[model samples]
Target: MVIYIILFGYLGLSLLLSRLNIRSKIEDSAQYYLTNRSLKGITLFFTLVATNFSAFFFIGFAGESYRVGYIYYTMMAFGTSFAAISFYLIGSPAWRLSKDKGYITPAEMLGDQMNSTALTRLTALLMIIFMVPFVAIQIIGAGLIVSGLTQGAIPYIWGSALLMVFILVYIWRSGMYSVARLDVTNGILLMTLIILAFVFVSRSLGGISEINEQLMEQSAALFSPQGSNSTYSPSLWLSYMVLWLTCLPMFPQIFLRFLMAKKESNFRYTSFLYTIVPPLLFIFPVALGVMGHLSFPDLQGKAADQIIPRLLTMHLPGGFGAVILTGALAAFVSTTDSTLLALSSLIARDLYKPIFKPQLDEKGTLTVGRISILILCLISLVIAFFQPASIFQIAAMTFSGLSIFFPVFLAVLRFNYRKPISAILAMILGEVVLILFATIFSGACDTLNILPVVPGVLATILILWLGHFFEKNKD
Candidate 1:
């Protein structure tokens, strides 16, 4: 009952805050989709952090840390900071282009820059394809946390359903305004809880020194760069570093958040926060995983994702545990809401209106956006219900899937590759290679053992270079 009260109370407060912030009726699709392009410094900072961290960082990162040891941290934690560099490189220019031309979706910016309707449609389609899996992973993480906390009284599917319903409600109501406003609250709560979890978990399992001593004695291999179980090779580490850096800034949801800033200067604030805060925030999860291994050494497979929730529920007092559990819920909601909103914006503004109804008015577009949110949420919920894999595995696959776009985005922004065929062919060939490698030849081939993104990205660049040469020869 206390858990329910705290969980519902947090939900109620978030909805109330969203309602209070939405003073004016949404006049157009812009207001609903991008909050009328009016996000300021702190709100932008929090939303970016909230969206980027997600359940992947809280649940997936901890799980991976538990499975592989400190090597996961070396790859992901440090690699994540490189996102600040990506923001400086790609985000700034994209924001300028969006502000100048009233671009709402990534497809719009790329389509206009490339002068190709095909590229626009393909960009939107690829985003939806890769993003749904990520959304599914967030929903799965939420379900696991709730089920673990309730000791399976809630069940995973029910928890996922409940979460999807809540996300659909607030997002369908006010769109990006609600998402951004709620993100601020979620960001603060989650950061506080993570810090507390680190301290509390550390204390619960003796001090940091004692935990270190235990790890050294029990799993000395964890201290090595390759991890206790030799889970990561040198090539795998480099691949993960590239994946983490490119994936965060290139993923459509996060890339679009860069456009949400009220001004270019807002990114400066976001950049500083991204660089300084994430390293501090990641410390807790790495520590949690290391200590969790000591506490629950027998846990294996999907069960690893529940380490944080299990620790909070079993070790902490009732009130504190409930609050921390709410924080976990906040992480899921923050990422899922942002992803649904972004995907809906792409579907409604980019795909539906352009192809089906070129004359879609603002009200019609907003309605379509709302409906798309429901449809996408249901799709993701169904996927989460099946419980495909661990959060880390699903997230990594999604990142690799989306990394196919990185080379194209870079070409559009920096390389000035203006040929639409180059972008289109690159996307087609890149996706085909990724699908083939991931499905047909993943286990059979030793070369792909590093990571899928490495080959996926290489395939994309190869196609782009070939297309560029052919186009140049024709000219």
Candidate 2:
């Protein structure tokens, strides 16, 4: 009963905070999508953190660590830390360009830089394709947590639907302003719960040394760099590292956040905080997985993803369990709402208004964006209800697909490759390679054992070079 009250209270508080922003008149799509480019300091920092640390971190990362071992941590820590450098390299310049030209979405920036309507639509299409599955992953994670915590009192499908509805309501109300405000609350709760869960679980298990000793005895491979089970090879690990490092900055959700900064100086502070915080935040979840392995070594399949929630239910008292569960829910809502808002902005700004109703004013555009949010949420809910795959696998495929845009973004930011043909062909070639490697021929050719991002990235570069060659020859 107390847990239920806490959960309801948390939801009520979030909705009230989001509603407070709805009273602020939105003068244009800029205010709706970018929050009028007014985010700064702590608000900017926490939103970025909250947006990045999704269910993928809490559920997927922890589960993978449990399944494979410590190698997952090493790869994630390095990949996430390296991603911070993007704030300087990619984010700062993007911020300056957006501030100068009033860019709203990443596609808008690319379209302006390359002067191609087709390229803008294509960019938005790819983001929707990749981001929807990413959103579905969060929904799945939330469902698992709710079901697990309640001991199946709420079924997975209902849990997922409930969470999605909650997210859709607030996000549909105020757009990015609501997302940033909620993100600040979620970020603080996430950090606090993670530390508390780690300390309490560690104590219950007789400390870290005992946990390590048990793991070594149960499976010495857990301590090995590649994991106790050889789940990730040297090649696979390298590919994962590269995939995360490049893809994190390019993700539409994160990309839009870069443009939301109030000033260039915000990026400097964001960079410093981003570098130090994620690695620390990741430590406890990875440790929780290690602890879960000791406690429940025989669990298999999707069961591993439930390790954290299960541990909380068994060890913590009712009130503490509710707090941690709410924190995990915060992580889910933070990511889901941001992705939904980004998707809506993409559809409304890039595709719907441009292609269908060019004369739509700011009010009409905001209406389209809100309606798109509802539609996208329903689509994602359907996907989540089916529960196609584990959170990590779904997220990995999504990241690989999104990574295809890295080179195109590079061309926009660093290089002078401004041809529409080049950008379009590069994206197409990258997507083809990603589909072939990540889907069509993934498991059949196990002897090669390369991650999809490895070839997807290379294919993008090759196509860009080929495009450049053709352009030069034409001249």
Candidate 3:
């Protein structure tokens, strides 16, 4: 426990370095939210990747890999690489637009483009509603990490509460500047430790042949695509690819990242890296989870979610799990900070000022944004504490819900694609379809092991296409 505390304290100190002598002017929203758009090169690269990834990258991936098999790798890699391509396709153009129009938030850009305050508020509300679960997943990972590190001396709720408070204070200190700086360090730390954890565990298992021999003897189901429990159906695999390609780019944290590029080349350089790097990093956790079955094959229920941590602590030397978990803690904190910051910006700029408090000045808006951070932290923590779902389940639901906004972004970037009403109808019907499939007719939704996002994304595009066609007919 002391070792875990010391390593985590070191991680905390590294994050604290972001606040050292970093003086940010919070009197203006753009300056606070975007770091004055000065991000580029390594800073931009780390910031975007770290902000885009969360505990979901490690905790969720490993857990799913443990549940299914390495086939989990295919969906995330292909899907996310396509999602990365959007950095050039959707992001570069949007960056230029934001630069020209002085737009800061996604809803602000969409609302102004379509001339609809209602759409602005609706988009903002939905993003927040869907994103909170994603945020809760971070807290859940942190809570699990903390409990594991302390050997259950600290309960999950208290662990989650600690992470929430830290994120709030960190954001209040210097906004995006601190968050970006923390991400630079955390990003490197997480990448290194994940790879290290993989090496250490694999070595302990006596390399590939032994692992394969053990797997074939004890858990042959791992080599199959249907997974140990037989959940990874073909439709579900394709659904994951589509979901990441469409949904990841629309995440408020990721969308906001588009507006922060210091140069056009930032998109080019980062796009290539984004396509390749995330997928490579994903392989380790998934492999670790698969290998984990060799040690603990009978992990029933949610115990599988703890596969990576259990593997690290039980297999490796003392204090090693502490170090790796510190990386885990950093991954969670890095994600929650960016997520909370982006959501606060959306609520403050898009909803609060325009809808309720039109007279708010820049400073007042900043204050509102900070306060919203606190409220959102509380809300996310509450959800984290009571969450009955696994990280993958929560992630799947949130990703699908947020993906409904893709058509709106599609119409926004392709000027010829917008008939404002068409975009609005597309977004609304997309969400409605998503809810129906996920709930009302869920049995029907699951018949072929299909996911709601598949239909949701298709329905969204179908509406947009129909709107475009009718407009041409009327013309």
Candidate 4:
């Protein structure tokens, strides 16, 4: 009941803000989608952090840490560093191009820059395809948290639906501007929750020093990979790093953030902040996992994702528990809104506007974007109803699947790999190879720590090179 109250309180606040901030019907359509391009440095910074962190960071990251050990931190390091690199390399250029061309979506930027209608359509199609899985993962996370706290009374579908309703109400009102402001508030709540959880939980477990001692005593591998209890081998480490380095940055939500900035300088400053903040955020979850090991080592399966919730419910006092749980719910809600908005924009601007109706005005685009948001949210709610796998597992699978496209996009921007044929070949070869390798030698390869996409990446490269060579010769 306390948890429910805390969550709805936040939802109520978000809805209220959305109602106040929404673009008036009399206002132009540009004000609705882009929030009049008036985001300042701080709001942009929080939006960047909130979107990038997501429910994946809270639930998925902690879950991964529990199952995989400290090697998960390496994944965070790879993602943050490489994403920053991509931001600087790809983001700066995309910002400049979008501003100059008045492009709103990534598909528009790619389509206009390359002058290929087919390429634009393909990018939008691929984005929609990938975004379903991505949005589904977040819905699963939100559902898991709500269902776990409510103890099976709330059903996953209802859990997802409730959150989505609030999200829809808020987004329908204010669009991106309302989402950004709420995210800033969510960020503050997240930090407060983390600091409090760490301090209180560590005290309960006997102090930081004692907790460290307990972890080492329980699983020396948690401290040192060279130790006998360590699960990660060299092969697994390499695969993990490669998968994250090549793949993590291309998240469409992250790319949409590059579009949200009021100025190019915001992108540059935010990238620098990313490198610093992600590592600090990793500390809270890493510490929680270590303590969880010492306290509840035998918990397994889906129980892993529930460790923190179980900890709070079983141990903490009333009001404090509600506050911290509210923070967790906030994390989930903020990430979901950002993702829904991104997916909606892709469908609205890219899929609907230029291809289907060349004459889509601002009002038409806004209607289409809102409608897209509703359709996508419904799809995710349906997927969340099944609730087969852990949210983290689904997220990891989706991340690997999307890894196929990062190289192609990076090549197009940084290198001269602009041939549409090369781009298509890379995506196809990479996906096929990934599917084949994961299928045939599935258990052995997975045990050996080989990423599903490694084999496909090699094929993608070869095909891309051959296509580029042929195109150059034809010229």
lDDT of each: 0.81, 0.83, 0.80, 0.72
Report the poorest 10 consecutive residues by lDDT, candidate 2.
466-475
Off-target runs (Cα >4 Å) in candidate 2 are 20-23, 388-396, 443-445, 472-475
Question: What does the lDDT come to for candidate 1?
Answer: 0.81
Q: Worst 10-residue stretch by lDDT in candidate 4?
A: 21-30
lDDT of 1 by residue, 1-475 (tens): 7777777788788888878848468878668878887998888989988887787677777887888887877777678887678787778888888889988888888888988888899989988877887888778778877776666788988888888888877877788898999999999988998889888988988898999898889988767789876778887778877777667777777887888888999877878878877677887887788788777887888788778877776679977887887777888898888888889889998899999999989899889988998898888887887766654464556887777887888888877778788778888888788777777778733464477667778899998888866775211
**Candidate 3 local lDDT, 211-248, one digit each (tens):** 86777787777778677667778888777777777787
Q: Listing every candidate in turn, what is its Cα RMSD in Å to the true structure after a full C-alpha superposition?
A: 2.3, 2.3, 2.5, 2.8
| lDDT of model 4 at position 57 | 66
Those runs of model 1 whose alpha carbons end farther than 4 Å from true positions after fitting are 386-396, 443-449, 472-475
Clashes of each: 0, 2, 0, 0
Clashing residue pairs, candidate 3?
A: none
Question: 1 or 2, which is superior by lDDT?
Answer: 2
Question: Model 2 Cα displacement at 370 (Å)?
Answer: 0.5
Per-residue lDDT over 288-347 for candidate 4, one digit per residue giving the tens place of the 0 to 100 score: 766778678877776777666666665688657667877777788788887788778778
How many backbone collisions does model 2 have?
Answer: 2
By TM-score, the better pick of 1 and 3 is 1
| Candidate 1 Cα RMSD (Å) | 2.3
Query: Candidate 3: which stretches are off by over 4 Å?
Result: 225-230, 386-396, 469-475
